[model samples]
Structure formats: structure tokens, C-alpha cells
Target: MGAFGRNHARVYQQLQQAGSVRLVGVVDPDTARADAIAREFGCKSFGSVEQMLTTHSEVQAASVAVPTVLHREVARALMEAGVDVLIEKPVAATLGEADELLRVALEHKRVAQVGHLERFNPAVRATLPLINRPMFFEVHRLSVFSPRALDVDVVLDLMIHDLDVVLTFVKSEVKEIRAVGLPILSGKVDIANVRIEFESGCVANFTASRVSTERVRKLRFFQAGQYISVDYARQDVLVCSVGSAVGAAHSFATDANEWGTRPSVNPQIQMAKPPITAEEPLLAEIKAFLRSVRDRSRPAVSLEDGRKALELGLAILAEIGRHAGRIAVGKG
Candidate 1:
């Protein structure tokens, strides 16, 4: 919700281009914002979810972009109205709310997708094919501080992205998790790092900061025989593997010293760097949503996936609190 609503509107417009979906209506508490989006998409604007559902009977699906605290109310209303939902991530502020949403969606037989946009990133798609047996992974996502999402900690707003990605890659249960964070610009923790140990013996080290010098979004995979790095910003993939090769002869002159000798150096390296093709991930995500709507198939990022990401994020937040308590006691 918040600025993310703008992205939801844009993605909906892109979905219209495929002729499978249409922007039926837009809703935001801010009338100006809702009107602006409606005008841009040639749709009607409603100031409340209740009014939107009542006025737009043709809306079979909705993009719920409300704040975390209001997610349960809005999503439940939409699901009860027989509309599929695509809710923005950290599905709900609390596990109870997320679980209730899941239950209602199931009871109503509605599709509730979560917006984890990284799953649609082209780099992720390209890297998925190359990964054989990932033993370890690292990710860093940093952004300059903004006051838009001060209600939630950095783990939910920032670290959850990497958590979803790691969970997708490992596909195993988490054995343990350790996290530490501190508040900098906002009352909530603005910088956080987490270490997750999966039952598959794979570990993921992740760091996310909303207060940073510059934005950095990257992931690294260390698997057997190779290391892969994907720079989401640059859309670049670099693969390094072990190789053996002979070094080219170097021309050297040792005239005065007879004992001077040239030592042979082994140059064993081969690097294959490929330019990653850029595609609009939001467009792909919306297209998938449309496909799910039409075919009644499961979403790429389903409600269950969102629940897991939220659970891990909440666990990290709890860990942060525990660490903070330790520091307070030490100071006393």
C-alpha cells in the first residue's frame, strides 16, 4: 500500500494491453490519488473498499494495496465479495491476520496472490536454470531511508524480499534463524541482517538496509564447481568456474645475471559473463495473475508462500527484540 499502489496501477494497465484483463475501478482513501489513477486508466474511482465493491460488480479481481494494518479488513471483504486478490507483501502485519485471510480464501474458493515481485525478475529466471545444488547463498538489498513505511520494520519491508527468494531456492524448512537490527532514521528498525539455516544444510546470509548510501540489489549463489552472481540493477550475470590453462610466454631479458630465471605461472581461469535480458517483471506478474484468473490455476506466489515469508520476517523481528533486550540489560 502507499507508493506501491502506483506500481499496482501501472501493472494493471500493462495487463490491459494483453486483452485478458481490464481496470474496472480504482480505490484509495485519498480521493485525489484514486481519481488520478482512474483518470489515467479510464476507470472509476471509489474512496472506500466497500463502495468500490458495491459500485463495481464487474470487478472479478482486485489488487489490495492498503496498509498492513488494514489488509485483513479489505482483503476479507474482497474475498467475501467473490473477487480474487493480489495483496502487497508481508501479506499481513501479523500471522493471525495472514492465517485468517488464507482461511477465508480457501473457504470462498478464491485465489489470493501475494506480490513478491522478485519471483518474476528475469535474473531469477535465468539463474534458476543454472543452479544445480546450491549449498550457500547471499543477498543484499539496500535503499536510502524513506518515511513512507515507518509502521513496519526493515525486515518486513526490505529483508522479506530476500527471504522469499532464499526460501524459493532452498525449498526446505528452516532449522534456525538469527537476526540483529537497529533503528536509525525511523522508530522501527531501519537496518537488519539475518542468517537462516535450512534443514537441507543450505544457509543464506541476507542483509537489508533502508538507510544506505546507495541502492544495491544483488544475490550470489555458491554451488558445486561455480559461483554465480546476479546484479538485478545492471541485469548482469557473472559465472566463475575453475579451469586450467597455460600462461602466455613473457618476454624478459636477463643479461647480466646468469642465475636469473623465469618462473612459470599457471593461468587457470575462464569466465562467461552474459548480459541479462530485461523484461518488465510487473507486467509478467500481472500476466500470471490474469492467467490464474482465466485458467483457475494457482499463482506463482500464492497465499501460502506469502504466509511463510511473513512468518520468517516476524521471527526476525522477534529476534531483533531479543537482541535489543540483551543490550539494554548489559547497559544497566
Candidate 2:
């Protein structure tokens, strides 16, 4: 099992201890790794999905944390075998692969979820109620370089998380995109900056870097007369509003004393921190997946939602490619 696969197993084991679900098994091509994680989680391990299915014929659902290219293959097999699946992000390597996965899920009537983990973050959940005609957004997700997740560009590996969140917040179709990226530490793009304009006149700027010295995960947006800041790592939201904007967010201002408030340097501006119920995002995401599986309901982050994010991510990559071409031409 890889890093994220082990995390899924751990969370499943935690759920099992609480009597929510059973930890059926873990699968990895590397038998030793699979066996290790299985032992750590107190479950069985198999070298492949087929081996696991052969032993646990009644497996109801599975988390496909395999590489992006193998996502469709593994997930298709599970759905065909009557097992719901939660596929990790960038749903698939290409849109064609994503479409095929979607078709298979529809045909099998499987409850497929995507691992857009940020959607379930306490801060993001807490900020949903505060959305009011968001017009502009600034997001940054930086990480220290690691060999992990180098198969994809930083846009897909890191920025896609913000893409999904912003898409959810804006709820509008993208109208245009401008992007630039570079390969610093990896053959693929290690850092990227993108600006997107939505059909509803909303604009979002995103910066993602896997070569950063310090880690930062934050998103700030401005609506009509209010500015909202979300610290994803800290699971906190800060809102600054004026006049009518403050009135609209009054319900969330009750805990200003507890959450600490910023003194209004400007007589017209007031700042407050929305009450956030901190819960491990992965736990919430997996719980939601199970609930969808049990109730045969829609997942919190459906495959379609994941596809939308991927579509935008791919478009940004395209823009980046074009920008790089222009630079090369100028150099020539």
C-alpha cells in the first residue's frame, strides 16, 4: 500500500472499531507492503483485487487509491463485481478514461465517490453557509518537494484541490483560463499559476507549488461587500464584512468572542471567525462514502464533480503548455 492507501485502511479500521463498517482487506501489488498495512489495520491483505474478491465475495465497497492510470481498471472491476468504489482524485489520467469509468458506474449502478478531501474540511464546510455572490478568489497550496505524487503536474497534484473547492463555491461554468507553469524539481510541472474566469463573472487565481520551502494551504475570496479567508490546514475561516454584509453574516458572528475577533480598524469593517466543528476530513469523507453506499444515495463528491475539476485542471495545463511554447519561441 502507498501512503494514501494506508491512510484509507487506517480510517476504515477506526470505523470498524466504532462498529460502522468492517475492514475487509487491503490490496497492493507489493505483497509485503499490503501485508504490513493489513497487519497494522488488523485486516487481511491480498496481492491484487482479484485475490481479495475471491476471498471476500461479499465486499460491499472499496477505496481505489491506486495510481491515476490504474484507477479506471481497478474501479471498473470492483463496480462490475457489485462493489461501490471511492476513486482518488484526478479521477483518471485522461477525460476519455474518466468517461469510461462514469459509464461503467452508471451501468453497474455503483455509488462512486471521488477523493476530493478538501470538500469535507471543517473550514470549508463551515464556510459554505457564508457564500454570497463570490466574485474573486485567491488560493495557494504549497508543499515541500517529495517524490510522492510526481506522476502528475503540480496543477493536478496540488491545485486540483482548490479547483474543486472553488468550483463548488462559485457554482458556475468556466469561461476562460490563463496559466503558466514550470518544471523545477520534476520532469513534470512542479509549480503552476492559473487564473480562471467563470461565466457568472467570477474570477479565481490559483498558485500551486511542490517546490516550496514552507507548506501553506489557504484560500481567500471576496464577495459583494465581504472578504472571506479560509485556512485549510488550520481548519479556520475569517470573515470581514461591512454594513449589509455584516448583517448577512450575523448568524456566524455569535462566536466572535470565543474564536477571537479582529478590531475594526476601519469603522465600517467588522471581522469575525465562523464557528468550526473540527473533524478529520478523511474520516468525514469516508463516512459520507459509506452512507452513500448504504443508502444508495449520491456521494458528497460524485464522479461528475471530480470530472469537472479535472476538466478545469486539464484546461489549465493546456494553457500552461501554450504559454511555455510562447516562451520557447521567444527564446528561439
Candidate 3:
């Protein structure tokens, strides 16, 4: 759909190897990129989405990897043309645009998947087993400064990944939110922090930075008697939980009349073993989309999921603006 169209082509080719789907065509406003991808993937290339859909009747689905601003238009066009779509995340630049795209998908009765590839990550899947009634969560996603994603702030660019994960674990509506952001490198906010309180009484603290000196992607979850940590980049999960023997030990001490004789000993902690790593998440995501298309099933990340992440990202941006205004007023 745009500059990152090449990645979509590559991932789709991998999915084809996995015996799911094949790439039938490529579309980009830039002829050079479009032609290059077409040659590499052995598919037809078109200068625009309209031309591609009009000329190709065999294409049953599309991966709309366009810019945030053009997401709605390209996705709506594909859905309106009766082609299922896998739209890259943040869905669209605005919630209204995302809503319209969803409406179009419903009108056409086609699948509209969102590209939240983290959902397919092996480490995230490993951590999923440990997520039970999380009381608190902390996430940090930092990346070395990149000029490629200057169109959006850090909240949309990075924080949304953790936000989706948090929302998945909490399984509740957000009751309150507070955020702050500033532009240290890019003109738009390059670093941001957000605190979200869910109706289930789970609190999440998230931080994202696109102007960092180093890159790190990690999340930690705290529950009643356990802690879970996930390292997305390294594909690792660490769990620390209190052992069941602790309660038995306490009961024995009480029977011995040692209730107040000594301070309560800490519960023994246990760690779970790591899980096997899987294929690339982007490739898995593409395969999932193709399977959904063929079986007429829902996607792993649906249009509504993308819309909720976008809404949360936009709300964080609004909160940042308000915080910045307060800071400016205080300085003046």
C-alpha cells in the first residue's frame, strides 16, 4: 500500500511457503517499489489500489501496509471491492476513519484483521498462560531514534503494543488514564508514559521511547502470589510464584505454638521453564489472515481490536497535550 509494502510482500510469500495463500498482486503509489515487489514476488503490480482492484479479479484479499494516514482509504477501497483486508496497526490515524473502515468491511461481509504482530510472538504466547487476574503491569518499549515513523507519536508507534497486551490480560474497561509525552528528537512526541486503571482493579504503567540510545522490549505483570516477566525481543518469560508448601509450613508453625516467636518466613519462590520459540510473528500473522479468509473465520486481531487500540492511543495523546499545557502555563 505504501513504502512498507515490500514487507507485506515478503511476509505473504512466507505464508505461501507454509501452504496457506499466495500473493496475486502488489499495489503502491510509487511505481519503483511496486514494480520491485512484483518482480520479487512474481505478481502483477499496480500504481494504485483502485487500479489493482479494477484490473485483478482473482485477488481475494489484501494486506494494507500503508501509512497511518492512508490506512482508512486503502482498506475501505479493498473491502468495498469485496476483498478481505489485513490492515497494519494503529488501524488509522483517527478513530472515525477506523470506524468507517469497519463499517465498510461489515457492509461487504469480509474479514478485516489488524496487524498487531505482538499477539503472535512466541514470548507473548508463553506469558499468556501466566496472566491470571493481574493486579499490576509495567511495560517498556524503547527503540533507537528512527526517522521512518515520524508521522505518529510514540504512543501510536510503540506504546500501543503493550496497551493491547494489557487490555487482553485485564479484560476490563479502562476507568481512568493519565499520560505525559514530549518531543526530544522528532517534532512530535518521541517519548511517552501512560497509566491506565481498568475496571477490574488492574493498573498498568507503560513507557515508550523512540529516541532511546538503546532498544528494549519488556513487560512485567504482578498478581496475588506470582510475578511474570516477558522479554519480547529475546523471546523469554520468567515467572516467580509462591509455593503451596508455604501454607502448610505456616500451619505447622502455628501447631507448634510458634505463631509470634519468629517473623513469618518468606514463601519459597518458583520459576517456570521457558517455551519453544516459533516462526516470525509477521509471517504467522499473514498465515492466520489467509486461513481466516479460506475458512470464513474471524482473525486473531480483528477490526474492533485495532479500533480499541487506536482509541486508547488517541486518548493518551490527548492527555499528553493537557499535561504539556499545564507545564507551559507553570513555566510562564
- Model 3, 90-138: lDDT tens digits are 8999999988988898889999899998898888887777676787899
* Model 1: per-residue Cα lDDT over 122-225, one tens digit each: 88877777877677888999999877867789899888888998888788898988889999989899998888888977888899999999999999987655
Candidate 1 or 3, higher TM-score?
3
Number of the predicted model whose TM-score against the real structure is largest: 2
Q: Which residue pairs in candidate 3 have backbone atoms (N, alpha carbon, C) closer than 3 angstroms, thus clashing? A: none
Where does candidate 1 stray beyond 4 Å? 244-267
Model 2 ranges with Cα > 4 A deviation: 245-266
What residue pairs clash in candidate 1, if any at all?
A: none
lDDT of 2 by residue, 130-172 (tens): 9988989999999999998888899988899999999999999
Clashes of 3: 0
**How do the candidates rank by TM-score, highest first?**
2, 3, 1
Question: TM-score for model 1?
Answer: 0.90
Worst 10 residues of 1 by lDDT: 245-254
TM-score: model 3 vs. ground truth: 0.92
